[model samples]
Target: MSDKAKIAVDAMGGDHAPQMVIEGLAAARVLYPGVRFVIFGDENVLRPMLASFPELDAASDLVHTDEVVTSDCKPSQALRRSRQSSMGLALQAVKDGEADVAVSAGNTGALMALAKFILRTMPGIERPALVAPVPTLRGESVMLDLGANVECDTRNLVEFAVMGAAYARTVLGLSRPTVALLNVGVEELKGKETLREAADILKQASHIPMEFVGFTEGDAIGAGAVDVVVADGFTGNIALKTAEGTARFMGELLRRAFGSSLLAKIGYLFARRGLRQLREHLDPNNHNGGVFLGLNGLVVKSHGGASAEGFKTAVITAIDMVEADLIRLISADLPDVPGHEEEAGAA
Candidate 1:
């Protein structure tokens, strides 16, 4: 038990709902005993899974419901019409203060739509960003606006930089982490006018503790020079999916190459340990999930296709967010939004 984070988890949310989701929750419960769960689904269905694990000695850790929200439903409509759905009910727990965080692997569109509607944005945040912790050559990186906001202005980009910097600092323990705008070219002139304008703004901003490292290319995302990469959801999501697809493609090729013959298999046997380590390192499901930044609280979303292991890690990540009090820190880190600080103060 680690202080009763009290997370609302959607048992019937993902592609493998209520099955792998149950398994992940059970696994997560063992590692973090203090995490009491509010399982949003049918009582008859959820109780069996909870009782199946004899390892869970305490009855106080779970709360089951009879409602479920599917991945096929529209996010906004699901929230509005299905008030009793697991997704909606679970979010209601957070809104009502019964739960500290919410985790879902269901319909991402609905998740975001419901989250924005139910939880609402923080004081100054116009919109929320989907931020994922990506592995870099050094360790990890923060990629922002994963799929939340696509079209952005200079201020929105600057805000993403600030939020991303705060996440890197508080989560990754990077002091004065580097911030970069994802651009086609490393030079300031390489991007659209918005990038140039954002560069001018960030160039003089003082609220953000990160060193505004200017622009970064896809190649440099893994180079480890920058801690935060800022872009709109369309670009950021494309990059994220690209990296994941490439990693999976490479793994398949290697498996075919190594699994073909006895000698190759033998060589792979000798090389098994190293290959396994590499696989673990590059696994998208390892750090594949991300936080919905600019919210007043921590909200983590995992892949709809996430396996049990991936969901388990997502739970761990959510636990870490609760323990770290990431939301409070992010709110506290910036006295004002960068590039807008001077104007706001003057007013």
Candidate 2:
């Protein structure tokens, strides 16, 4: 890796396509002058767009590929066309050491599949988990397995805890981030056997740089009860979507309430500033990057429908992970677990 972080971008993957990708990279260039970008997409289209942003053009290298992985493309289809597709080639850039990280506003399933096939998993890690930082009342907290693996065993959950804790340390800048299992109840014996077993293992592993606070309920995630929340993909995905929906619902209700009558409109004038701040806090673009943890190299997934600013946030996130040396941190921490040696050998 050079002093400047090299980010491989899948320019043709998002709903807004090459335009949004280029716009976002241009914006990111202003914020991170040291970083460079390797953009993979149609040269004919990107070349013309690059003419508009000289700073980004000077900082980026364009790799042309007409092939693209569509929004509806399945994981199986993407694997077959990995070499030619924009998403696959960007990931290949990371695997080949041409780039420190890869960022894509692409198909989630296809991105995960191509990344696992190309970069492979870290030692002692069976599968990679999708993690993201969520805004909480207390501050920012990290959550894992957003939708990567639908089902996970005790070992997988334990690995997520380890990975999530490392993410908190790097992204949240916490020396010893508190971790908890997402469960139906906070009690030790409340959830499935896998949850209990995972908690028991974390409790005993004192060497890891995290404090295990046992189980946490679904509602506690927004309250920021712990620094890292670990759950299987099915549960974590549902919780995340529900929270997003609730935020939207509240925003709409506020808009309707403030417009209901003359007096309501008068009251809205007094609360407009606070409401604007609240809207910014709840904006999906503010928290757009979803990291694929446990991969040999760094890969970040920007939302497919993300705006230019949202995609810029994802690019910055990839740079942060590279500068923080997240992969090395997780690799170093995994061996400290009690039974990770045996697991690595078996894998």
How many backbone clashes does every candidate have? 5, 0
**Candidate 1: segments with Cα more than 4 A from true spot:** 55-66, 338-347
What is candidate 1's TM-score against the reference?
0.92
What's the lDDT for residue 84 in model 2? 79
> For model 1, what is the alpha-carbon lDDT of residue 104?
86
Per-residue lDDT of model 1, residues 1-347, tens digit only: 34568888877788888788888877888788767877788777777776777654252345556666666787667767766778777777888988888888888878888888888876656688999888778888899988888798887888788888878886688789899999999986798999888888888775557899889999988767689999999999999888888888989999999989999999998999999988998887788568888776667897888888889988888887788787776666545555444544443
Top-TM-score structure, candidate number: 2
- For candidate 2, write residues 254-312 as lDDT tens digits: 99999999999999999999999889888888988999999999999999999999999
TM-score for each predicted model, relative to the true structure:
0.92, 0.97
Worst 10 residues of 2 by lDDT: 338-347
lDDT (Cα) of model 1: 0.80
The per-model lDDT (C-alpha) reads 0.80, 0.93
Residue 261, candidate 1: C-alpha displacement in angstroms: 3.8
The Cα error of candidate 1 at residue 169, in Å, is 2.0
Itemize residue pairs with steric clashes in candidate 2: none
TM-score of 2: 0.97
